[model samples]
Target: MKVLPSIQSPRDLRLIKKEHLPTLCEELRRTIIETASKNGGHLGSSLGAVEIITALHYVFNTPEDKIVFDTGHQAYAHKLLTGRQKAFGTIRTKNGLSGFPKRCESEYDTFGVGHASTAISAALGMAIARDQKKEKSKVIAVVGDGCLTGGMAYEALQNAGLLRSDLLVILNDNQMFISKRVGALGKALTKLLTTKYVQLAEEKATNFLKRFDELGNNAAKLAKRARSILFPGTLFEEMGFRYFGPVNGNDINEMIEVLENLKDVKGPVMLHVVTKKGKGYKPAEEKPTKFHGIGIFDVDTGDTIGKSNSVTFTQAFSDALLKLAEKDKSITAITAAMPEGTGLDAFRDKFPARYFDVGIAEEHAATFAAGLAAGGSKPVVALYSTFAQRCYDQIVHDICLQNLPVVFALDRAGLVGEDGPTHHGVFDLSFLRDIPNLILAAPADENEMQHMLKTAFDANAPFVLRYPRGAGFGVKMDDAPQNLEIGKGVWLKKGKDINILAIGNRVHPALKAAQALAEKGVDCGVANMRFARPLDTGLIDEALTLSPRLVTTEDNMLAGGFGSAVAEYLTDKQADFKLLRLGIGDEFVEHGKVSQLYDQLGMSAGQMTDHILKWKTK
Candidate 1:
């Protein structure tokens, strides 16, 4: 009889024999690995957190007692235990189970989480709410060590400490945040691991003294004090949390014991649980970063299945930056704990001294880059478009206000498939374009991407280069990157009926749409508008002169986006033309294949062609 198959809920999990819990953890790990191998979701962190999650569910009465996950990367086991086992394989797919913990998905998921460093704050709110309602349920926040690097976590910690609420915070220290952990906090956590012998001695001493009853309680207190002197959780203790453990989070028995003891602790308590990033799987253990957020892979060999041959926008950015940094010694690279994801790993390897991984602090990364630029180095802060939203104020006040020559390489600036709304980079154009002293450019292809990168560096101002996720159009690479003129666009095709103004990755699709429309005797002109901030007024004028009907397309949201910019320009000029804006609407786009999302949003070639035909007839 399979232990996992029988577990429909945490209620069922709690009924399992204590001796059989480890077997259940093994089954959970196996299930996660199998599901993730096919679905291509977060594997390493989820694998590492299996025991911790299982222990939490087994110890606590969830649905009533809340367990909030920080980023949801480690919530696969939680999901399985919370009656999502059968739907687990459908994670990260369209109309399927969400990869992250979602409140709407189940009552067990107390809070919907996608971004990091939010769980502690959310859990604190729940604890306060529970108090207000006069309920006696436990609230726990499972925050990873990587998320600790973010300033938001510290802010929550200090506030939680001040409030002195009834809260249980489990610091899941795997020494990773997507990539390898960095900074002083990581060093502090590593230092805690060195006191394993002391932890063992304290555990033994406490157990041995229990025979003396009241004296044993005092002796246990003495042991805890002695242990605390050596324990790194002194930092958390100082923050008003009753710190517990350096406990083995991988051991199901140990985790359950620790959780059982800490669950009823008064005031704010933080348990520092240490687990390996890739505990069970050999391949993930070998390369945790690679397996962190991997594609569909061969379960037998741990190799990626159906890997693309074409160069990705990330790869293109990485290659171009490498080339640029070779000649320009002043060029420095920065990432907010996303060196590998943002293609800054190559730059970090090549220029170790110049590279900086700020660790999940996007706001700091922006300001730090600004400071570097002010101090006479041309710094490029590479970040995911979604993460970049966290640093809008930093970008405006620190970089743009000062007119600092800082380049922002905003990758995955459009629909980032599978990661869904929280991860999608769709809002960059709308939010970023209005800022003064900022030049926002989006490349239509890999070739254009290189030039835009070069253009950004040469501009000597706050420049943003936004590009879509996944493989770029297999256009031939230029021999050398050239700095193209700012605020200029090129016409790909000119037609009699309507002009299609497209930007970034949508240009190729717009061209295809034009071709399809042409077959139906509906003539359409296409122009690649390179920059979003500086609207190509001349291009727009030319397009309008050719035909009154103008269709604007982008991978960004239609509201206050590229189309809005064009519309703003046209309305300001009092130009009479039929405007059909083709892009994502006011709703959040969900996780799916990029192609499927594009079709659903009416941004794909076929969909765009059909939309144009319908609008033209209208």
Candidate 2:
């Protein structure tokens, strides 16, 4: 009856009878659902992968036999079985278990992964290591169909095909990649090749051919050959991997059989397994995206608890973009595998033909947008701040160099909470602001985000509008999206005393600091400085008039950020002012609540005000 307690590692699992694995899988699914509901994690993907992970670990000798998971979101089941059951309660917490596969966490985790389409390459290296050592161990990589769209996966596949190394690639085709998969490959395979009806027909034909002894060998072989040509497996075969499946991924018995058959399979092998996301849970199965990475939901009702009263920056951009799209037919949106997470699901739905979901290929998405822009269609590619880093070269060479009008809306542009350094969006400011032909703007509020988006779209050069994660201050939106005087900073408060110029989300906190200082009989001037690239130089000259007193605040690193830009401007103008730079210092922020991180960095409203009061007194 005690299933989870018995298994310490893969070695312990091998001792168990094969028939008992179904129960173990059931327990694993229950454990995943229960833990995810409490701690909040990749629910649907992890739940869907319970049987597959269980079967793989049971069949293969892990720690000896290497297994790599692509994207790492679906590795919860793998993690749970690999002596990490105790740490399941603290998933994604500070000093707790990481959400993704981390090499430091366990010996079983052979490679660290957060980004998509990397499993094949990592597994290939492990396989190579095994071959060089003359060891008899398996190398398996479990990747989603969604990650297949990434160019890296194919690149690795091409190499694997050429090398003919013993590698097993399990394609977990759940018919969705965060949002439903886009592009012709996903459509063709799901619709025509791997359809349930088509697979059933193929199975029936194969079984029927086996009855004839004399003719069966040739006839069955011919039918099998024809099926391969007609299906998506041939595509993988052409790439140099022997292909199997369209197998039922949820069925423990079926998965065991397929994996067992492929244990001794030579060279590269791809087993395409069909699965339903959120297999056991009804609510998750119905609306998997909403529950993808949830936060403490009611398991019985399947409804998320404690809805935030505040609206996140992502929601504001989504709303603003939808309105802009309504009026301008030329405007279209694109995301690299993130539709729901980036808040572009509504836009994607409204303009199905116009919208593009270019899987986990940010580089391709950037270039594709350039091609779209060159063709005269206004393309707005909204990607996460961290993910945006992957396409920096493309932005510089393909879009900015060509002077294409492509607007990149970067979400979570600063220290994103909980997911830690890997998911943090801090580097975009340093990276994008330095680019030569690109125009980069960081918005202060919801209304400002809308206005900046319009400005970026209209700008002839490649542009980026970066905003931090979480809710805005519910600022009233009276002004519609308009073309602003480029490189402008609006003064929020007029004072003859200390000048504080802040960019993006830092502007609001600086305003609060100014108010607190005003209460303490200290007059502090405030400016909501919008553009990071073409900064308001004239305003900087005026702010320096408040002599021997000024400060620059930003939600980016103090080095090579807004503060550094301000210092550069003053130096260039030969202006004299004792300027204090306030921003994240040179250190990687840890996992915690957003507010806590701000407090730690001394960037909070109270901390800023207190510091200013002391500075004025001295």
Q: Largest TM-score belongs to which candidate?
A: 1
Per-model TM-score versus the true fold: 0.93, 0.88
Task: In angstroms, give how far residue 556 of model 1 lies from its true place.
Answer: 0.9
For lDDT, the strongest prediction is: 1
In model 1, how large is the Cα lDDT of residue 52?
91
Misplaced by over 4 Å in model 1 are 176-227
Off by over 4 Å in 2: 176-231, 494-497, 517-522, 609-618
Error of 2 at 595 (Å): 2.0
lDDT score, candidate 1, position 433: 88
> How many clashing residue pairs, candidate 1?
0
What is the lDDT for 387 in model 2? Answer: 90
**Candidate 1 weakest lDDT stretch, 10 residues:** 176-185
lDDT of 2 by residue, 266-304 (tens): 789898887888888998999988877787788998988
